[model samples]
Target: MASYDLPRRLVAEAFGTATLVATVVGSGIMATSLTADTGLALLGNTLATGAMLVVLITVLGPVSGAHFNPAVSLVFAMSRSLPKRDFGGYVLAQTVGGVAGTIAAHLMFALPLLEVSTKVRTGGAQWFSEGLATFGLVAVILAGIRFEQKAVPWLVGLYITAAYWFTASTSFANPAVALARSLTDTFSGIRPIDLFGFWLAEISGAVAALLLFTWLLQPGTSSTLSSEAKL
Candidate 1:
């Protein structure tokens, strides 16, 4: 991997996250504008978000491990793949970039730059779906990095694409993205009041994956730990 300083990595994380959230919010707006079918609009949003993940991760992975999601960063921090000192920076950049992404999307769509979302997305099922979605996401990321480093981007993009269809909450597996989405009152938005459940579930799910994969990927010999992934 290329050696980049902390500032560069933060910039990459922010930029990648901004682009990702932009794609998500922008596509949702466009889809709803063009269609009345909810499913079709969701399909459009999913495709754009998935495709952008592939592109963003492919280009920025070397710079910042393409950790556009705070949940992903948290997992890396817990697993010791990411330095403790850098974890806060990563989360800050992701959150700031995510909000900027919402503003950018709103600008393009001629909507308010910031608004409280009225979309009601809450309940036991939704929270559970968020947890399960994030668990699978972190699991895939860890396994991909361990077994196939070069395929991490594609693996993540594809996993999210599938998760979007399989999960009840449409797989808002990313905390930063979820927060950004709440700033928009569009089709992709979630109610701001519902953020706590999503955040709790996402963080818990990521930690769970880390604990499971740490053991699952451990080498047979007790003398050695599981292979360390840089990202």
Candidate 2:
């Protein structure tokens, strides 16, 4: 990941985000078309999304850390894992790529290039769910990096698979993703009006997780000293 240049990394971020959003929006459309039962439709959407995450993360993580979500990128930037200078570029790439993904999905399904989502998804419960979902996501990511770097893709994929069922908002925990979803009126879409609430909750939760995990994952002074003594 470190060996890649900034331009290459940015391209990877954009491409990865585009593919992720395409999978999300595309799967939703396919699922809804296949099933009348809401639960069955959601199940189909969830499986495709989770599976795509694993594939994208595994393939692109080495290029750009595969941060398709702005909230995840925010956490990495704050932690200095991703440079602050590149944060804006990352967000821009992700947002643009996400919208492109929505458009691509629409093209595949013979829908309009862009349609404002009308599905209502706002209010206190939904906001809280978004917050909790993002918090858990960031925590899982940081912990995976610390303890099991190779398993991050599966960890994220599985977590989101579970979150889709458990969360009221179906865990649309990424700000970039939320914005992209607003452009499509489909099974996965959230109303454009609801994006702000989701974004606020997601960013807040990500920062909160970063704060707690930074302290929690840090080595204690005593432990450091003891290790040095052994050395």
Candidate 3:
């Protein structure tokens, strides 16, 4: 692993997360303004978010492993890929960056800077969808890192793009992203009251993926996983 200081890595995580959320919120706003068709708006948002993921991960992965999502960071920590001591910093950075991204998108669209979302996304189906979506996301990430390290960016981008449509909650598989989205009353937002279900589901999915992959990829091994194993 190429040595980089913790501060630099944290900065990269923050910057990358901010850009990712901006891409999601900004594109959703743009899509809604341009079309009345729900499917078309979703398609536009999905494409923009996916494209941004590819670019951001490619550019920032070397710096911080590009963990813009808290769920991903937690998975890495549990798998011993991310240092336990640095876990809190990663989560904090991602949370703050996510909020900043929401604010940026709101300012760009001339909307209220901190509107609470009224979009009520709840129910058992929605929770199940979130779990399924996050499960696939973590699964793909771990598998790609282990096998096709060079293609992780593209793999993640494509998986997210597909998951957006397949999942009921539009695949808010990221905890930070989901929390930030609640601050925007836009097409991609989720109600604050519904946050618990989403977070629980996402975390559960990520943990499940981590355990499964650990068993499959390195059965009976206890060595600490390297943070720069592949990313």
TM-scores, all candidates, are: 0.94, 0.95, 0.93
Stretches > 4 Å off in candidate 2: 221-231
What overall lDDT goes with each candidate model? 0.93, 0.95, 0.93
Off by over 4 Å in 1: 221-231
Ranking 2 against 3 by TM-score, winner: 2
lDDT per residue, candidate 1, 31-132, as tens digits? 999999999999999999988999999999998999899999999888788998999999999999999999999999999899899999999999999999
Q: For each candidate, how many residue pairs have backbone atoms clashing (under 3 Å)? A: 0, 0, 0
Residue pairs with backbone overlap in model 3: none
lDDT of 2 by residue, 1-231 (tens): 789999999999999889999999999999999989999999999999999999999999999999999999999998899999999999999999999999999999999999999999999999999999999999999999999999999999999999999999999999999999999999999998899999999999999999999999987799889999999
lDDT score for candidate 3 against the true structure: 0.93
Which 10 residues in a row give candidate 2 its minimum summed lDDT?
218-227
Clashing pairs in 2: none
